[model samples]
Target: MRRRARELAMRALFAHTQGGVDLEEALRHALEEMGGEDDPYGDPLDEEGVAFARRLLFGYKAHQEEVDRVLKETVEGWDFGQMSKTDLTVLRLAAYEMLHEPTPFAPLIEVAVKIAKRYGGEHSGAFVNGVLGRLFRRIQEGEVKAAPKED
Candidate 1:
């Protein structure tokens, strides 16, 4: 369920950032593309999955500046313009979860890498893993502080 939610959230973020769609519209389109409840050919998300996806979407939006900043700082050589949209979206979602969610960093990074591999370019998984590993180490070393959880 969490994986599905992450996938949905990534797609929505990608649409919003790359396709220039608004957040709600991007989410609605992602849900429909991923197989809405009414789509017989698609794998529909459960209620919990949808809810979690919404949390990620809104949470990321709420902290988009910090997330992007962290990503920019952590990425060694690549500029945001040079990064693939899919990879950037996965990183943004992962960074948001890392900052706000209670989930451990390993699982979050693992999920992000998996999603990157599925949706990104050939080297995306390694790229995401490298960047996220650096980010996690920075967090652990007190170079980055996790934000307070929002209500």
Candidate 2:
């Protein structure tokens, strides 16, 4: 359920950032598409899953500036413009969760890697894993602080 929520949040983030869609609209569309008849593997999120997805989406939006800043500083070699959108979106979602959610870092990173591998370029899983691993270390070392919880 959490993994599905993360995937939906990533898709909604991509739609909002890259496609210039309104955030709420993007989320609604993502939810609809996920449950739409065309998606063979689509299992619509349960209510709890939907709430989690909303938390991720709004939480990320609430802290996008800080999230992007952290990502810009943490990512090695590739600039934001050079990274795959899917990979970047996955990173952003994971980063946001790292900064706010109480979930353990290992599973968060694992889920992000899986999502990247499923929806991203050839090396996206590795790229996301490496970057997120570094970010997690920074958090552990107190270089990054968790953002205040959103209302």
Candidate 3:
């Protein structure tokens, strides 16, 4: 269920990136296309799942500039624009969750790599793993700081 939510959020982000729609609108449209409030377990519009997706989308968008900066600094020798859209989305999603969502480092990084392999191109899994591993290393080394926990 959680994985479904993440995938949905990524799809919405991809839609926003590729379709040029506002992020909220893109998420709405994606859920609607997935069957709205009706079909739950049978469709992608899982109730709890959408809530998690909404959280991810909002968090990702709210800190997009900083997140992009982090990605820019983390990934060496690759222009952000040069990234494949799928890979970029995966990285952004993973990066945001890694920093904010309180999921553990190993599971988070592994999940991101799996998603990249599922949705991204040939090298995306390895690429995402490398980039995320770098970020995790920084976190371990106290170079990349996490925001203070609230409540």
TM-score winner, 1 or 3: 1
lDDT tens digits, residues 1-151, model 1?
Answer: 7887899999998989888999999999988788766544466789999999999999999999999998999999999999888898999999999988877787888989998998899999999999999999889888999855433
**Superposed Cα RMSD, model 2:** 2.8
Q: Relative to the true structure, how large is the alpha-carbon lDDT of every model?
A: 0.89, 0.92, 0.84
Q: Which ten residues in a row have the lowest lDDT in candidate 2?
A: 142-151
Query: What TM-score does candidate 2 get on C-alpha atoms?
Result: 0.93
At residue 9, give the lDDT of candidate 1: 98
lDDT-best of 2 and 3: 2
Q: Candidates' TM-scores?
A: 0.90, 0.93, 0.86
Report the C-alpha lDDT of model 3 over 65-113, residue by residue, as the tens digit. 9888999999988987899999999899988987887777777788788
- Give model 3's clash tally: 0
Candidate 3: clashing pairs of residues: none
**Deviating ranges (above 4 Å) for candidate 2:** 147-151
Best by lDDT: 2
Backbone clashes under 3 angstroms, per model:
0, 0, 0
Best by TM-score: 2
